[model samples]
Target: MPAGVTTEGCPDSIHQMEVERDDTHSLKRSMSTMQLTMIGVGGTVGTGIFFILSEAVPEAGPGVLVSFLIAAAVAGLTVLCYAELASTIPSSGSSYSYTYATMGELAAFAVGACLILEYGVSAAAVAVGWSEYLNLLLNNLFGIQFPDALSAAPDAGGIINLPAVILVVLCMLLLLRGASESARANAIMVFIKIGVLGVFAAIALTGFNADHFANFAPEGMHGISIAAGSLFFSFIGLDAVATTGDEVKDPKKTIPRALILALGIVTLVYVVVAFAALGAQSAEDFEGQKASLATIVQGVVGSTWPGTLLAVGAVISIFSVTLICMYGQTRILYSMGRDGLVPPVFAKVSPKRSIPLVNTFIVSGAVAILAGLLPLGILADLTSIGTLSAFALVSIGVMVLRRTAPDMHRGFRVPGYPVTPILSVAACIYVISGLHALTLQAFVGWISVALVFYFLWSRKHSELARLQAQAENLTGDQV
Candidate 1:
């Protein structure tokens, strides 16, 4: 046996070699910095800015602006850690792959579970939000809208959310086509969404009222913190850039550049849109406002045309969000499947398309079911908790890799080193702490289920374990 192969499970020389081999042979490196950045921005901006204000504004009142900054701060810190790790140890699994290389297989599986929850549930949540705007757009243009039974989830007093399910299925088809195709589609949507938001800000500022600022912090700092937790769902796209590590061209340089660029674009758009929306309407009025941005615009201009335009933009932009979210989820599962942490079917790529066909289908089906049955609020909260946990792990992984493999070549180093990662971890924890007790409880239960699966199945079937056993047998035969 080669000295690089070892029974010890830490990612040593052999593991790095295997990862490189997989990168070279498995996924195509077709994504450029611009394509990847659009993926990040597309995955992020629509979900929160389009409809999340309805949920977040109620929690923080006029102070939801602070909530946006709070979430952005945490996301900023975590993306730095992601940039460093992605350049240092590129993988399709994102944080889960980072944890495996630095921490070991079991810990990696836990992070994988968190990521599954984050991307999968967030995809469904975004689709549900998409359905709202789709309904509004239809009503505006054609004077027709789906009945509540077809447009809403069961929890929202409907039989099933048909539009949401249809959206997920459409994204699945895009993903099945190929990565580059999806990125191209995403880029077009990103540009349209940005233009729409710019229009919204312009129109909304016309009605800017000073009184909205009168009770800015009505719910205080605690409320701001809670809203930040919910708003963190908006930032999941920043890390979605890292999940394309294996599929991005020159990932070492491309991933970090994309992460920073996407972060800047997303944060700027979010703050501008939130400020404009708040200025146009009182914080109290934001609550329960479906298709909130469009409604705000209509009120400002006293014309349905402006609102209809915004609704058109929301419908198109939110589709890109759902597409990228599902893309990220499938890539993560592909990595896990390759490592024997999940079923092998997830690892299977199409010979012609070079994409995970079965995996995309499975993810789409599951997300479709979730989007059809559950309310958006529940899906968003669950996604936030899961995403925060994964972000925390990535920050910790940076520190662990520094200590364990100090000599590893890093394409980009975090500027502040230990302080940066520590702060990232702290920020994630603080936001997570502000989540509702029910959310925390649900996350705990999810983790428990993951651990049980890890023990009974993943640990035994782990690719690392199989390799270790083979190495030991070879050594014994040599002896």
Candidate 2:
């Protein structure tokens, strides 16, 4: 038996070796810096910007601009840690993989469960938002749209959200084709969305009124803080860049570079859009505006054409968001399956396309159900809770790895080290504290379910445990 091998559970299991070999041969390394950056953009810039104002503006009034800045700053700190870990770790599970390699199996399971919320439910939320924009587009172009019974969830006085479900299924089909194809599609959507936002900014600026700034902080600092927590949903997908580390060219450089670049660009866009929207109308008017950005555009341009263009852009771009988010969910589960934390079927790679087709299908099906049945506000709030929890864990993992494996080779180190990670953790805690009581309750219920599954199932079936038993018996024979 090798010196490090024991029944206590070795760090390097046989299954992991096989998984690594498969990954080397299967997963394609075709993502350049540009592709990677756009993936992050595609993931992060969807519902958060297009539909979030209705919720955020009511919370923070005109001061939501400050919320955007605060959310960006916290996201910035968190992704710096993600860049370092993604560069250091060789797994594709995003924070879950990093936690496993640097922290431990238990922590990895918890993080993985939280990620289900971040990526899976987040996809559902984006799909729901996409449905709204799709309806907006239809109404703008032909003066016709789906009835409430066909377009909304049951809770929202509708039968089913057909468009959201359909969108998820379409993305599922594209993903089954493989990663490269999906990446290309995502790149196209990214450009269309950004271009539309640019046009919106130009038209919105035309109606800018200085008087709207009179009562900027009507709700004070507490409102701004709470609003930042709600707005955190917009920033959830920035770490998708890190999740692609395994498939990216020169990941060491590309991962961190793309993280910073995407974060900066996204933050700037959010700030500009928020400013433009606030200038065009009163903060109180944002509430209950179904398609907020389009409504803002209509107010500014005094016509429906510009709003229609913006809606069309949102409908096009949010498709990419759903695709990428579901992709992230599958890849994370794929890594867990390889590690024996979940069923092996999840880790199974297609021989022809080199993609996890089954996993993708499962994720799409689940997301479609959620998108069709659940309310958007609930999905977004749940996503924020899960994402913030995962970010907090990753931040803590940075400090833990520094103490436990100081010699590990890292492509990029957190610039401020202890301070940055500490601040990241603190920031996550603050935002999480501001979430609604119902959101917290749902998160706790979900975590309880995940932990129960781990204890009764994943822990016993873990490959590392099996390998440890074999190593112990072999060592006895040698003695």
Candidate 3:
């Protein structure tokens, strides 16, 4: 084994050969430009604008509209950095994979730890939020409620999140069936989300009393910044488009175009939705109606049908979001396994489906437990910090690659060079600083677990042993 690299499980089960990748190990680049765009939109449009917007609008006041733009700018900068890295590398495992190949094994292990929280928590949070809307749509359309007693948590005053767990299980099944849902499904979901949001904006525009704008900056700039911190999580998934490297067709051309297109669409929809929502109701109303935007719609529209329809759309869209987040999580683990930072079991693909089953199962189980047990607000905050930290890494990696491996052929280059990536890092830090003190404490607590594991286990058994052995052989040959 290498001096610093380590692992948690058996490392000698497989030969310590420095494996070389060929065309087969590579992903079949079959996704079209349009499909790639769908992924970015699909990952971004779900749950965030539909559900979180209603929750955040109250915090930022009408200025939450401005918070939308602030969050988008930060996300857009990170997406640019991701675009460069994805095109230059053209592989899976997103950040962990990139860091391993460029930074080293220790960095990779630590990154994999953070990624587990980012995608996994995002998926679980969306599932829990989806469950809330599902219950709302059901009770309005039907007469029976799932009852708060069993629908939520004991802490939040519910028993078991049966709906959330069920949805997570269903998404896991879909992923296991050898059917990797394509990016087009995302585009369609984006259409539904946007179309419904458009209707929501149009209708709300009619009831637009300027009175809603009277205390627009009620929370003030500081409050808006704090609200933007909350909104940041909703924008976290945009980079999933960059994460699906090998799966994308003509990555150089398709990747950049898709990222920009998706960012534009997502930002427009979020800002418009926040504006219309604040117009329809006051910020004070958002706190009590935290679960679903439907309650807000009911207050404004007087009938339950519009709100019910909105709930139906959110339920459908959030289900897909759960799937994508889990998909990214598993792929990241699989990449780490393939790199020998963890166990090779994670890299072991199902011969029948070409999917990493072990990694998928592990992620699904953890996410299910989390969504079923934790409060929605805690999960949301945890996911935001994890994602921002990851985005910050990718941004710096892009800049480093520009310097260290300047000759490496890049399919896409971040426009404005150093300026863009610098701003990306700065923006991520700014929002991260705004995190509630409790959120910061929890994030520190979560990452400490990963660091401890890396130093204690992963470093001792890392695949970097293979690289060390090769170096030794070269020295012997020279002698």
Q: How far is candidate 3 from the true structure (C-alpha RMSD, Å)?
A: 5.6
Residue-by-residue lDDT tens digits, candidate 2, 1-479: 21221212323532353346345444666788888888898899886688788899989988999999998988999999998877666456888987886677888899999998889988998899889888877887788988999889999999999999999999998888877788888999988889899888888889999899889889999899888887876888887777775577777688888888999989999999899989898998988898788888887878878877877888887898898899899989988887788998898887778787788878888999999999898787788788888899889988887776676567899998899999999999987887779889989999999999999999998866677788899999999
The C-alpha local distance difference test score for the whole of candidate 1 amounts to 0.86
Go through the candidates in order and give each one's C-alpha lDDT.
0.86, 0.83, 0.74
Candidate 1 differs from the real structure by a C-alpha RMSD in angstroms, to one decimal, of: 3.4
Tens-place lDDT digits, model 1, residues 160-225: 999999999899989988999999999999999899899999999999998898998888998998
Best by lDDT: 1
TM value for model 1:
0.91
**Candidate 3 — which residues are off by over 4 angstroms?**
1-27, 51-60, 147-150, 154-159, 178-184, 209-224, 278-300
Backbone clash total for model 1 is 0
A best-first ranking of the candidates according to their lDDT comes to 1, 2, 3
lDDT of 3 at 431: 76
> Which ten contiguous residues of candidate 2 have the minimum total lDDT?
1-10
lDDT of 3 by residue, 87-154 (tens): 66655678776666566677667777788888888888888888887887788888776778667866
